[model samples]
Target chain A: MKNIFTGRDIVSDKGYITKRNIIEKSLQLFSVKGYYNTSISDILAATNLTKGGLYGHFASKADIWQAVYDEAVCIWRERVFSGVRDRTDPMIRITKFIENDLRNYLGADVFEGGCFFLNMLVELSGQSDPMSKQILRGFVRISKLIQAWLDQAADQGLLKPGLNHKEIANFIVISLNGAAALYTSTRDDTIVDQTIEQLGFYVRQLKA
Target chain B: MKNIFTGRDIVSDKGYITKRNIIEKSLQLFSVKGYYNTSISDILAATNLTKGGLYGHFASKADIWQAVYDEAVCIWRERVFSGVRDRTDPMIRITKFIENDLRNYLGADVFEGGCFFLNMLVELSGQSDPMSKQILRGFVRISKLIQAWLDQAADQGLLKPGLNHKEIANFIVISLNGAAALYTSTRDDTIVDQTIEQLGFYVRQLKA
Candidate 1:
């Protein structure tokens, strides 16, 4: 296909492409060395870009950090939410969602660090930054998704009568985060395995 | 009161006192800025120690990290485990243990970066350093404690009849770690409230 756009148009397209590249690379570095530890120089080095090139796309180091956070949220929503969207059975859908999540997390090119949410949560919790607000919005979004999933499960009779969807949703979110924390810290799949098993047991208990 | 040993003994006591101060200050800095982000100069600035004086105690930056980890583990054991040592009722003891844990973790001074276990877990998980090994050991030790508590509770008919102690223990640990992760990220007490509520619900299920 012949491209009609040229010059400034191509430059804008390349700008988006370069920004994505920088964000992905920054995510890996930040996950490994953490946000505070990863400097602008580190991001530049990873992207093999000059300071002028980097700043042309991002106003500051904080701007790039926000971009990375946004990309991570996008990937998580697509990978975890989209994977479970088609299933009619709540129990199966939930199980598949957990399975896909573990697979994506573990089947990585590098074990840089843990979940972006958990990493950002710990790193930015006490610091007041633009990125902190983004992290909070991401967390609230995940919790709400879990709540919605549980509510659907209960409505569909996949959950036992009188089960508390809100409580169970909170438990699922907390336990999954915990499992991710443990897995990232230990780099052991067993923690993930145990979490999966325990989650399965909890879900099975919801059956009438 | 007159000390029994003078001169050398007093000097030794002073040495111990200074070392404790170094470790305490190092913990705060590392917890705040993390391991790689913290430099020897940062420690010196925080403690007002000259290079020679710091070298007199810790051999390197890694040595200081190890000391911080050890001190954190020591305090964690004393605060969380000591309360559960003598209780015969597993359910009651576990509940008390969780409550004590929440209190310690949610305290204003200690609540900044969440639990040290979690901080190190994310910070040190992929590294091949001795400190990483120590971090792993601490994780195993904490998980085993939960396992033991669950086993005891199950034996005494304190847990739901069909529950597996190992699985439940894993769930409890994961949930606790997850709560810490959330609290660390959000720096909000709502996560702690959710954790306490979840633990209470689980405990009730365990009780006959």
Candidate 2:
């Protein structure tokens, strides 16, 4: 992990940290004020970077936004995905995946602003841009990951007969995003608990 | 219904229509670009109104936003709520509410961008402002409405024994917002269908 707070950076980590600093600062703003509301000047003021300094690292505001999004995905993997990535049991992995996102990833450590991908997804929807397409790809990737686990669960005979893993995965993804949408705005932990409980109920019902 | 397209204002409806025009245009921009991203200039250009003319109706951008949100609530009543408002049966009312929101409201006619309340809630979360509080009130209103229906269902022995209407309402609210988050971004009707199907399943399980 790049140390974004250190005033002085080591020779090897300086450039990387500087870039990380810009991305982190811009992300905080973008997640809060949103992409269009956030300006280059806002990022510069937040990061204490000159126009030339910021531009040297990022060509434009859009460039910085892309980096922020990439970093957000990395944060998801490190904070949420990494926990479930190595689990051998598909059911456990799926359960852990949902658990981590609801209990931790959507919590303050990962983002007080809530799920970054979902935020960007809704914010950038209907836009005809590379960024928009890229966001869509991110959702597709996450959906595929969930669906793969669900398929494996079926193969292992862990699911109820005739159950559709694809639709189940869709339900998990949709409901989780919905829970985030509510919890993110409400900052109400009970909402998270309720959503998780319901999800757990669904998973248990799929037991053979 | 106020005629939004007419250039010549009917005498009694002149002031009402002018305010409606500003609200309508601002709602469109706020729906697409969000509240903070939208500027007064953007609204002016969209409405073809001079600054003074616009200010005559609203004092500031925030004022316009408040109006936009109010208009959004009104739209909700007309398009989604009105269908379920008069129904005395709790189960049928809840079903109609969800169906109208998913099938009609979240569809293109009501908001090509998506649910205005959800958008604002997510966009305005964690902010220290009147707008944020207003948005919170909107969510509370919806949640209470859903909860009331669930409570009625429970009282009438239309629900599963030991069922908790509070949690169920929370689940419904969270999941519906989730569906909107996905459907808004994907523009896929199938996602809506899947969410509705799952919700219907939940409703069916509540039967005694």
Candidate 3:
């Protein structure tokens, strides 16, 4: 039998679509209710699929989580970085990335609950499982991206000579996550506006 | 009967002790595993209590959650505010609060998983239940404390004129929450140190 959940085979075109549909529904459920709170039965209920049907698509909920996470990363990258990918100026790229993240992705509430990664990051903080690693890996990837840009800025003599790039990257990540979490709970867009403005000021101040 | 979960009547002294014991254990479980992920069975296992014994203390899991949250709040206030509560200088109170929060609370890993309020705030972000409300209220209480201090500083001509007190309070909160969440996930002490230093700088900068 063909399988889309695993990369063993191409799977049938219809099977691929069905798998995608399951992933999409599960993403919403997991984003809002989180991984542990959301169960296979919830997936089946939300997808309107029978147990046998859902199991046929993904071997387990963990595999489905991996697939959902991959989809979220793609959406995050496309929405937050697509505009700045071609920009060579590091400050432009960094500022635009923060702007896109704050205004477009987080402020826009791309996911029903909020940023998929932030919600899952807090949800999976202490777990040592593969599921938890995936969330941490996403955070590392973003941190690395920002660190790379900061290093690039330093190489170009745009950023100050003595700043710790990694710490700065972590700071940006922490502040944005905190802002997004608070905004989600409060449903106050002003938090988003203030965060965007403040973070923007911090980013610009990083210049040489 | 004397009831601790609900203030109805007095039960046995053993009952009150048992109730307190359950709340303490459940606070650990819920801090790490979160509300929906932790089950009544998990509580029974952690506390080594029978199903009937557990039921006698809490009307439901939700009630247990309330008791645990109240206990966490008391602990939080006592640790994070006890020193600053006696100080009259707003900046001293503010910096002392942040220092206690970072150095003593988060940096020391006072809770096994991390800050209880940060964990629960993210866990319950989108929910509208009373449990979620309690977490949000904890956040609001903190924010209000900071904002009130900021306003007091302004009145004393210690804070820079025309600063948005509410926005500044939110910034400190957003940054600290972000810092704690990241620190919890990474188990990095430098994050806490850097956060304290930077937040201290930011606080000092707020003065006239």
Collision pairs in model 1: A121-B185
Which 10-residue span in candidate 2 chain A carries the lowest summed lDDT? Answer: A1-10
User: What's the DockQ for every one of the candidates?
Assistant: 0.60, 0.63, 0.56
Q: Write the per-residue lDDT of candidate 3 for residues B1-208, one digit (tens) a residue.
A: 6566866566566777899999999999988888888999999999999999999889998888889888988888778886897899998999999888887888888777788888887778777456667777777789899999988888899987887887888888899888887788878898888787767756776678
Over the stretch A93-163, how does candidate 3's per-residue lDDT look in tens digits? 99899888888888887888887887887888886456667777778789899999999999999986788
On a 0 to 1 DockQ scale, where is model 3? 0.56
Better of 2 and 3 by DockQ: 2
lDDT of each: 0.74, 0.80, 0.83
**B1-208: candidate 2 lDDT, tens digit per residue:** 5456774556647777788899998888888777777788899999899999889888999888878888888887777776687888899999888888888788654775777877777777766457777876776778788888888888888877887677778788888888887787777888878877778766776778
lDDT assessment of candidate 2: 0.80
lDDT measured at residue B166 in model 2 versus the true structure, 0 to 100: 79
Ranking by lDDT: 3, 2, 1
TM-score quality measure for candidate 1: 0.86
Q: What TM-score against the true fold does each predicted structure earn?
A: 0.86, 0.90, 0.89
